[model samples]
Target chain A: MVGPHHAIKWLVFALCLTIGSAHAADPEALDREIDQLKSDVAALSQTLFDIEESVLHPADTQVAVFLALKDKEGLELDSIELYLDGSPVSSHLYTDRERESLRQGGIQRLYIGNLPHGGHQLKAVLTARSANERFIRREVRHQFRKRPGESRIQMTLDASAPDYEPVVSFQEWK
Target chain B: MQGLNNRMTFKRWALAVLFSAAGVSAYAQTGHPELDRGLAQFALGAGNGALALRYTQNAETEQDYLLRAKALLKTGGQSEAVRLLDALIEGDYYRGEAAFLKSSLVSNDQEERRRLLQIAAQKGHGEVKQQASYQLAEMARTNGRPDTAGKILASMDTGYWAALGYMNIAADYGSRDLNPSRALISLRVAMAMAEEDPNKERGEALKAQLLVRAGLLAYESEDYDKAITFLEKVRLDSYSTPQGLYLHGLALTGKGKHRDAMQSWHRAKKYPLAFSGVAESWLGTGRGYDLTGYLGQAGEAFLSASATYESERVTLRKLADMVREKGAYAALLADAGETRAEWFLADSRMLTQPRSAYLLRFMENAGNQAAVHRVKELDSMLARMERQEHTLKVLTSVLDERLANSASDNKPALGHVRTEIESISARLIAARQNATPGSSSVETIRHLAQTLKDLETSTDRFDKRLHKRDQRLRVLHQKASDALEKLDHRKRKATDVLRKANAALDQKFLAYIDQESERMLVALERAEQQIAHLYEYLALQNLGGGSQ
Candidate 1:
């Protein structure tokens, strides 16, 4: 093992290299980083494959979707705010005011009759945490419908793809 | 550090043997030595199939074969897995686990389904145990061992196993069209267990199936109320299964709700073959239209039904007796015929009542027929005697009523009235005796007439005093009312005393008539005796001895 003095020297060298090269690195260093990324991707693929491989066919674990509705309107009105994990999946603009009830606390709730499938919102409240960082408190509010035969129901919230990965893993009971 | 070194050494030894099994050709397939080594490592991790195939086609590497055998199941080689498990069992290495897994994958037969279930019960994980038990129950039912299925299901106590078991039993009962009570009991037990097991998915489906079946059984038993209740429960739960809807339709039809029944039947068009063809034929024959629509539509429906019914020879034969009776009032008849067995079972006693009475009267008047026939070659003595006896009974009852009225009338002589009634009754009894010598009813009539004659004499004498007493009471009431206006005068005092005297005198006259009471008591006793005699005569007629 290297002594603490050697580790400190290496750390300083890494910092100096980062500050000097910044956006322009040597080809050798670039190649090393590319190789490292390739290895990381392959490792990730293997880990996923291994986890999937562990389960026997006719698996004990099943993925299920609970399609719940609070108050659904059918074929009468269109467009309602939707919430997923307590955060709004849409811009805070009200499209159907007759259905959207506004309370005194600046909180908006939609009385949705039905949702169209695919590319919809999970109506939620966006609370500002600070000037730079905003915190989203989300609730699973509505599931929109799509024209029959759509494959996936995409919840289009400001949160990035990494935030809603858990839903894809579930297999609906039907 | 020593342990890590040892583990690495073991892994390296394993990897080297596996890599060398690929032979020189596979080695040359990868250009660089480092890349070849990586490929070899990936191949080792590629699972038993890669190792075994590499070993078989290239080098005869025993290490690759050994590892291949250990992980054979990972490659979907179930038979190979079983073989390896057999070898492991012989070697006593993971014997139980290997044997259990091998049994599970290696068999699809029902017997194997049962055996695996038993093994699961003995040594399986929680979910495995539950699933295996359910599978075994289904296998048992398929193999015609419902009792075995029931016992296994009972032992399960909860979850999908119990629900499936109950559902199977219900189906078995439905198939045989017998032992519905037993089937219902099993289904209810299953439903109860399922309700307690919150995570069980089969609960709702099984409950719906059981309810539909129970409703049908009740319908068959003619318990319309219960059938409606169970079937309505299924519908309220939004159970739209073909059989459930069909039975709901049947129950509605039973309750005479033909409009609703038609709606249900229309929905049941999805399962054409599920119902008996007779029901389909009934529907086709305009039964629904007859109930709810224009007569023109009904005729069309019937015509279509007849065509369809005739097309299927087997169904035609089964339903020939049913649909041939169709008309405006045919539904009532069909309903009656269906419940005929129930009616016979229920009113067997009441049906015997009038049957015995008619038979008795016939035999009493026809008992001498054989004797007369023996005397004449061509004759109906019984018919002649029956006619005579019937004529006499009619004459006797008419004359008796007439004589009774005349006796009660103050203008008619009591002796003449009595004479007329007695002579008519005597003639009727003599006629009955001549028809059937030993008939008890003839003697009973004679005794009744004598008692009535005695009652008539006493009634006439009592009526004389009663009429006089009534007249006196009416006069005394008038006197009492008149004396109220003259209460202070001597005339009022005199009238009051006279009214009291008149009331006492009327009471004395009524008390003197003991003969009327004695005659009524005697007449009533005779009437009771005549009723008893009639019952005995009826009994004799039923047994075919009244003619004698």
Candidate 2:
């Protein structure tokens, strides 16, 4: 009969070899799985961010300020409250609501007289209260000027995100 | 036989003498045809043929009696004049004046009046002809035939006579129905005649006065241009009274040279309304200083303008407006009394909340009240304007809706669609069978469509350009960032290299400079020592030489 010690050593050697191979393979496989997971996580995070931006932002974050003088139509709107450097311009604001508030955004309609042929602007924060639970918010720094007659204002927004498309827009009476 | 015949002849002669005396007495006592008839009846009643014959002879000899009869008839003694005229016509004497005068006095009974006027016209005498025309005009007036009277008056040729007849005819029309043109023509002719001949038997001054009257009549008749010409003719520059100045200013203002008008007004302003101040102001001069736009001066002007007029008068509105337009602070402040305040408040109220006089119950009761009168008239005008505005809005909207609905409904042949397209041309052609005139619906639609197409094309082009620009900018930005990073790296390497080169060069050059400086110092020191020795030797030599 072969010697038991030799047999045991051989078996042990095999066991050691298998365990060593497993150990080597385990670390490599775990590293590869971790790398895959990191890529997937990055992709998922980007997708989530894009979805949130589209759903919540509703508008471009970087707004271009403009000055505009709408025809008499501008005056007929529900309220035209202009805030300049966080203060109300008396000429543009119907009336000051309170010290705490810069202007009364939802004041009654103003009867603005005929607008002389010229351009004007108001840098402002616009808040449109909705019939629903959500409040529409716009941080606008609009910069537009009027011409002699009827003219259209085309606004464009710039942003840094890769998937974000710069939005262009205009306003018209309904 | 001789005694009887002679006695009878004596009786006849005596009877004839007695009848002649009675006839003479009767003719002396009587006056006209009636007097002659009475004398004849007296002679006949006395049973004396010789007396009757004598009375007839006596009546024939009385020329003054016939003249008295003509005078009575000519003076519109209608019955007496007609009786005398008839009796005179029966006679073989000339009776033109009596026939004419009697015929001119016929009553309004058309047949009789025409017969009388015709007879008078037949005479061909100028005065008789005028009287005939006058009678005809009277008939016309009495018969409600003023237009006929005007026509007749217009046709008359002789200036003075025609003018006289026209004046009478115009009077028949009364002031309300008066044809001022006819009146003016007549007056002008009369005036010229009076001015030229002025019947110097009457007076030249009277003629001039007549001219003035004619000019005033023309001026009041709304013939402003003619008034100007006529008044200027009579105007004497030397005459400086309010009336003269007023007329002068009126003429100038009517001519519409406002500056000259203002000058006249200014000169005339020294006079009050009772003195002609109003006419001056209307010509637009001599208003208050307050009305002049000079703040300090306007106060005085406004005060004067206001003071010149009656305080309770409605004309104060014009003065108030003048002061307001002057924009003088003091003038406005001073003018804002209770009355002015009420006016302002009323105006403000009207401006803020428009009143519809038609809807107000008080309006019906306001027959003569000032505000009521004004509001009623103004409300009607405003209502008409509002109606026009509403109509325009409706028309424009209808056109718009027609166009929109047409485009959506795909009805290409719709009248409104055609109208919409036609509107762009602004040529208000009458609408075709189905089209409304002045509606350019078709043209409008075509223009809008073209504009929308252009917008689409432009938007696409703009989008492409912007996208390209954005991409180019981003790329350029990235390249700049990379170039900056490379430059930073190159700067670091150059700085390190430069620092090492500078350190080395500094050490070498500094050491060399120091060494050169040290060598010079040492050489100088040695040379100095050598020089000192030489000098000492020389000194010794010199001393030895000096000692020698």
Candidate 3:
């Protein structure tokens, strides 16, 4: 004998009670949902970053320079300055790992940048201390044609010859 | 110019020998004053360029060509030097000096150099002949022709040069070949020849240097007693370099004389040689105490040494910067009060490709706090599920057992029997209440009472069935308890592995910090020493006009 208004009220009360019960069944559900949302956002952000990097630095125009030592015992490298086409590009003071790598006949990637295809002059200025405690500064220059692809330059300090002074040389990667 | 002077001096000496052989006593009257001045300048190791220029302009003798050749070599004119040396080699005078110089210059052509050295050895005079013979022997030895080397050495005349040659050979034998026994024999021969040399003071000085070399060789060869014997004979003031002191310390340490070793190391640290940093590092770390424990002091000494060398200092500084940066990040993570995921997110944002992999691994494994908590939650949930499953299984088995007992015993089902019993009890109570003392319904009441008693017996039978079911359920619960116990043990083992993995990661991080910092410190110290040495070298050059 309930009126339509009273029946609608009862229906609304029932719906609210059911919804409250469902929510109360698992209190940590909201927290888990929030964590999932955060994880998704982070993953999306990382993907975007990767895409940006790939779009910004493509392969063809990239140029890289590597430095190495033939014999580390005879010379203690202090610092090195690199110049491309008469403009300074990179200057680095050596780190222990870098020095150790050189001593162990390993090479370090010293500089990376982009360059247009053409001839370029690269210069490396190296400062080092000799085994006899003498400070020595050496400058080496090389002219290379960076064709329509990536260019790689390798600068090496060779101290293998016993009777001669240490020599620095440059080579281009094909 | 020095070459010219040396050849001129050799010519004068040869002339004197010839005059004496001819029984001429007035040879000094023929001596040239200009030649004497050149000889004096050559002896002082000065003005060789001017002397060579003068000789080139005059061009009077074979010695002048030799001097010009030497000057060309000094001035980086190697091709011109070689031509002049070839001319001298074909000439009559200064052939040995020219051949020796050519041998040094044409090192790539070993066979020709050896042949030239042979000619010099056969025809050269005084020290020149002795040096040529020694070099030929060295060449033979290096070519793996030991017999030829021995023969060459045997043919050499005993003199100051011969003594020096023996010492040089001994040094090669001991250091390069690791033949200490053979080196000792050569050293003994050199000592005997040195004692017999005409220049007593010079011979003794050379012998002392030889003794120091022998001591070090013996130390290297691990002949401690022999090393001590040789080292004791070394003259400290003239021959005690930092290396010598360091070696002496090692020898003392080998002999279990720690106090003496410490004393030697202390003295070694006072010198500004290359080994001084090593000595300081050793002393700073309590002479081989655990380096990990004394990292700060050890790093300081190492960095100090690194600073002495320009290249090494730069390297050390870079290493230090990297370590400092990484260490600060690690410290931040360690002190962070936030959840592991939050920390990881912040830390990973600053990481590059390969480094970011560490965070990914931590996030995946139970190595991080968040991951561990997640694992623990899963483990707890699994345990609860297992408990509920066990309870359900026990309940199902009890119900099945009750049904089987009811069927085998030909008894009524438990639910039907209980319902009947309740109905009978209610009827008996109603009938008793309705029956009066003289009423006709007394018989009906008595029948109801009998039905109630029978129902009570049926209820007791149901109780027995229920007791058997309870016993079976108890057995199943016991089995479940045993299974849960095994599960708990396995969980504990897995947790232990996780803990160990976390500990290993921490240890790796700590070790990276410690080792890189130590290396940076040592390199810094070495660079500082090298800079100081460079400065000292420059100052000395300014004061003395050239490197000593």
Candidate 4:
């Protein structure tokens, strides 16, 4: 036993409730705005990085070194000290969490700097522990000629099986 | 209808990005074993797949190809994964794994999967021989032959994991599937095999878990002595320690050692309540105390258990509400040290996450994990596209400036030269009309030469205005403008879709939170009931003592 006027009023009330609830529950509007700004800011960084590379270290003189830990090497990295052209350029001490992250396997950029197009030396001193809790320290030096465009070195900490001795090797990426 | 269109657009955009990213750069395989590994572990090892794929896009090695195939599957490119796997299989690199994975992906037909599984089982390559054999055994079981399943499991080729699987199935038989002796025998075999697993930390952890499982099965069958022997050897640091201690307490109670049972339950209750038997251990402590004629202490123990559960319930509700309010993308990152990097593992700080156990359990579901991952990927893609958009804007501006300098700067001078050429042609036609046929031919020739010299002098001043350079600049400008327009349009569409997708993911996260909230409530209610019953018993005991 409802009148048409009352029915209309009820429908209007329900519509308002729906709109109000939707608005109240929606945090995505603010999030969306913030993300858009972040995206816009990120856009500026791409060009900024490109400009930084050309302006700071021109391609002809740029040298980049990358590092990676061998997968399932049965050894834990402790620390690394790196030298480029007899100058200390980079060093890192690995925490347990950092070591765990590295265990999942990905290349980490060690250093990037300007070196003239000619022969340059990269020296690394690494300290790591084997599965048997044996502490090992190793030092290795590599010499490579920088090319016209860009020079990149991929450094790896590997282990030989059975005794699982830690070995550090460097390869120039082509 | 609008949502559908946006989804389709997003899918097309995602496909384009993946396919284009698949265009690998040429690089000679460095022959380093490290080159074979990638963040591909992120796909299966709780890392990011697209990020991993990005770093390894220039892979040249067959092993790298296998890694990419796995990564592609994680990123929803199943067909692409299948194609890569097929190539690897044909080339005789990881043929077993490739065949098994591709067969699973490329068809829904059971017959086809079985055939490929058979191929994988017989193949010599790939590290999934045990997994493939297990699948075959499972398929046989599904076809209603339990005997055949057991036989298949028993006949798997000899390896650490393979032999362990055989022993595991035998242990399964010990659970009323076969004689109790067989179960005990198989569990002993599994225990021995697990000790030989090469993985150091994981091997030790698994061995401890195996002992707990064996002890539980034994305790279930009223073999208290055997159960105590197995449970006593469990490492305190192992994940199963709570369950082990709880079961050990029960075994002690069966032997009528009330004090020993209480001590074991006391140790078990010290662990996180998220542990399977930790809450039950609390109740067991109360029950032990009541049996030992310490009814007052028993009542206190039950009250303590109830309070602990109620506290956890409050924390769970607060966390769930936060997830619902902030949306999943941000809430997910807040639990672990307020940084995305902290997600590699849970932070142990109580202040940072009061309910890390429950949250970790929630993330164990693959769907919930994917919900978070999808939002992350979308945000990353949007940021990348935004960066490209800015770079394109700079490019367009540079091109426009060059076009202006090279062409627009000389536009007026070129126009004047065109007018001069027209005027000279008109004058020459007038002279031709005025002249008699042959008279003064030398004079006419001299006049024409002077006019040509004048034209040459004027045109020489404007020599920098090369038509070819102008045309090139104009074409470059037009192309850059067109590219800018298309990218802008796509970015707008992508922004809209990513926002909506993010909101949808948030709802999924909220759903998980709701489910966990319900579980916490149930546990809290059970604890409250136990506390009330314990208090009632204590009151009845006091009343009987007074009457006596």
Please report the candidate that would top TM-score against the real structure: 4
* Per-residue lDDT of model 3, residues B1-548, tens digit only: 76677666655644543443243111111133333223322311332332233224333456656665665554345665676677677667778888888887666888998888987887688777888898888788778776687777778887666677677678677766756888888898887877777766667766766777777788887887788787667554432344566677777777877667656666655543222234343443244221234434444544444443344335434533553454323333332332244322333232322233223333433334443343333333345435544544554455445445544344456667678778868877887787796676786576556645644664565466555654644554454445445545544543443343333334444444355346546555544554455457557758897544
Per-residue lDDT of B2-83 in model 4, one digit per residue for the tens?
6466445544544554466554322212234453253333233444445445444545556666777776665555556776
Tens digit per residue, CA lDDT, model 2, A1-174: 779999999999999998765433332233233233223322222222222222222221211222222121112112234443445542233222211111212111111112222234534443333223234345555433332222323222222233222222434211
Residue B291's lDDT in candidate 1? 63
Instruction: Report the TM-score for the A-chain of model 3.
Output: 0.66
Answer with 2 or 4, whichever has the higher DockQ.
4
lDDT, residue A79, model 1: 33
Model 2: per-residue lDDT, tens digit, B1-548? 76466445544543453455343222132223333343333333332222233233334322322443443332222353355455443333324455565564554456865766665555536656665766676677667787876666555445344545554554443365454666565555555544433234232333333444455555666556666665555433222234444555555655555456556566655543422223335324422221333334333443344444333133324333443453221222233421221221222222222111101211222221222222222223234334433433443444344334423233333445346545633432332334544578755544445544444444344444444543433443343344334434434433333333323323332333344334334433443443354457568978999999
Instruction: List the lowest-lDDT window of 10 residues for candidate 1 chain B.
Output: B371-380
Ranking by TM-score: 4, 3, 1, 2
Instruction: Please rank every candidate by lDDT, starting with the best.
Output: 4, 3, 1, 2
Candidate lDDT values, in order: 0.43, 0.39, 0.57, 0.66
TM-score of each: 0.33, 0.26, 0.34, 0.65
Best by DockQ: 4
Model 1: per-residue Cα lDDT at residue B151: 78
Model 2, runs deviating above 4 Å: A1-174, B1-66, B70-79, B89-96, B103-111, B141-157, B166-225, B235-248, B255-548
